[model samples]
Target: MITFPKDFLWGAATSAPQTEGAALLDGKSPSTWDKWFEMEPELFFDGVGPNDTSNVYVQYKEDIALMKKMSMNSYRTSIAWTRLLPDGKTLNPKAVAFYRDYFEEMIKQGIEPIINLFHFDMPWWLMEKGGWEARESVDHFAFYAKTAFEQFGDIVKKWATFNEPLVHIECGYMGDAHYPKVHDFKRAIQVGYHTLLAHAAAVKAYKESSQNDGEIGIILNLSPVYAKSEEPADQEARHKADLIYIRSFVDTVVHGYFPQEFIDLLEENQLLPETQAGDRTIFEENTVDFLGVNYYQPLRVQAVENPRFPAQSPGDFARYYDWPEKRINPHRGWEIYPEGMYDIAMRLKKDYYNIPWYVSENGMGVEGEEQFLDAQGVIQDDYRIAFLEDHLAMLAKAMQEGSQCFGYHMWTFVDCWSWLNAYKNRYGFYRLNREQNYARSDKASSYWMKQVIEQSGFEYGGHL
Candidate 1:
């Protein structure tokens, strides 16, 4: 049987907008999502929006207790920027009080809290000013980071600058999945570059403060790239895909600079983002102390004959091709590839100075999960259990091969609202009952997770 380190952390993670229901309550202002839901309600699934979440705002106490019962020693959650700084600058006293009480309760229950600064919930006021593409937003975000550090840095020792920075840029600028739906490669690069700047700025602010000595990091959703075949064309296509999808953020945050080839390619197309003075110094000086990896699947790239967009953006030089024979998660429409977890770990070990890291967000989402409910009021989510077991085995293998992985926090604790997809896909241990006033019910995987946490390892053939 494989055993994890004695101090290995096992918990669940959730973002603010995805779980907290009070979108505009208690001196909280509207985020980009709040404004988007009002303007385009039909785009959301089941007509559910940000305001209709797990109501963690009012039920965090009970939620923490549930976490305790589940044997979660660490709980990863983000503080909504709008909730803390209603206008992105001014502090909301009520919001501050709520978070202080909420975090203290988690600590009182002996649960370590990992707080993330930004998690796709941009304040509506900031988005109007070009969001991450604007240079001014960098300083604005730095101010919020400083305020958060000063306020909660004592209680929160582990901090993350941003969660899935690439997702916001891809969904918002390069694709139509998020707000300000503009499909422009140039704008996407600008948004991505400014986001890295904001991260570095936040790190700078955190270090400048005379607060408690704590750890800071960034969470990246790294999807390893693979070529469809050994053909030169496919390999070339895969290289470009890696440059855009993988190296774009990983290289910067880990290595403190953009990939040289990526810069040359963008320069060739004149899609380079506007930059300011001393930005390089900020990046060089403020690198993350740790990294949080969110791996879901790998990208299978194949050369496209008649490329679109002049090979300037993702899916232009090469497009993702699904392997038909590969295992698939029918519920969420994503490939179920556990090997990608090991690939990510090895890549970090070989490429990024072997920095300490953890699996920050990895979980499966199933639609119509209520159908799995049994007579005992528990959801028989054996599929989730199997998924976790497979991935954990792979993670354990990576650790054996010398990967510095300290924890594993699944995508969420309780089934919460997802952006755009809404509540259509459930990725929580505790199922949320929509008809019964958002009641929480334990799923089969929840019990399995409890054992894994308490034992600090999952023995082969142990209660499966």
Candidate 2:
């Protein structure tokens, strides 16, 4: 029998914009997502946009009761900035009262609330002002952080300043994958720097303020990069990939400074952004008390003599290459190697002073729900169970090796709105029925996860 430590945190994660459906209610202003859905609904999959989400804003009480049924001791959720401060200036009393009630209800149900301040839901007003790329936006974020801390700090203890800052930089600025898409390396670097600064500023505000018992941190989606082969070129490519994807933000948050290699890369390519005199001090002075790691997949890279682009020349930029064929995950597009999670944890333990950390997000995304359903309206998601079991085994091995991993929280509890994919990829333990009263049904994986949460660990059960 594999038994976890007594203090293990077993919970599920949900972001406000993804789960909350009352997008326009309670004096809520338009967030970037709200605006994007209105202007370009074509970007969404199956014509299902952000406004029509899980409706958890109004159904949270029922959801909490479901969580109790799953025996979840903790729950992770984000606070929509627009919902809290409609105009991004004045605080919305209704919003505050609603969240306060929510938090108090969770506590009353014996569930710990892990509140995240931002989860890719930027207010449209701020985005119009250049978002994280502008220095003024960082000040606005700090103000928002202070406002949230002062208002909800009495009940909420675990605070995550930002969720997946690297994703925002890479997807929104460097690549055209996410909303407000632009392909400018220099702007990406600037946005990345300002994001780190914003996180540090939020941490500083949380620490200096009257919230003494609250623990503050940031959520990072750490995708461990691997080389296709043992060749020197492949190894070099792996290092570059790691620097670009993982270390740039990890070093800044963990060590309170940017990685010198990253700075050198930016400087060499003439892609370095303008930095103020006191920016370094702000970053160095305020480091997080903990870390939230969202591990989905690994990245496989290979060296390239001259990276190719569709355009002739997009100015000086740091470029590496991807070898998609060398790595594979047939089930999902992402590369699935459970060992990567172990390597990430061990590396963090060795290099980053073994900071207190937890698996904030890890799960499988299936294309459809038919594979898991029976004729009697029950869904048996055995594949998801196997996927999670493999990852949990890796996490357990890491824990045995002295990695200070506090707990594991899956990608979500119920099917929620995925940004651009809309509902293309479902990653939930509970199957949500869009047709029938937004009714939720427990999958086989959900039952398995409940047992795992009760046991806190897994034993050898080969393909059970």
lDDT of 2 at 36: 85
Q: By summed lDDT, which 10 consecutive residues of candidate 2 come out lowest? A: 310-319
Best by lDDT: 1
Highest TM-score among the candidates is held by which one? 1
Mark the regions of model 1 whose C-alpha exceeds 4 Å error after superposition.
Answer: 308-312, 461-464
Give the Cα error of residue 26 in candidate 1, in Å: 1.0
User: Candidate 2, residues 1-464: lDDT per residue as tens digits?
Assistant: 55668789888897998998889998998888888889888888887877789988888998888888888888999999998988878999999988999998899888899999988888898999899888987888898999999999999999999999887787888666676888877787788888888899999899888975879889999988877788887787778777878888889898988889978866766778788989888998999888999998876667666754421222212233455443444456776678889999999899999999999999888887767589876777777787788888888889899999988899889988898887778888888887788888877887888888877766657532
Name the lDDT of candidate 2.
0.83
- Give the CA lDDT, 0 to 100, for residue 212 in model 1: 43
In model 2, which residue pairs have backbone atoms overlapping below 3 Å? none
Residue 265 in candidate 1 has what lDDT?
80
Candidate 1 local distance difference test against the native:
0.90
Return the lDDT, model 2, position 272.
Answer: 80
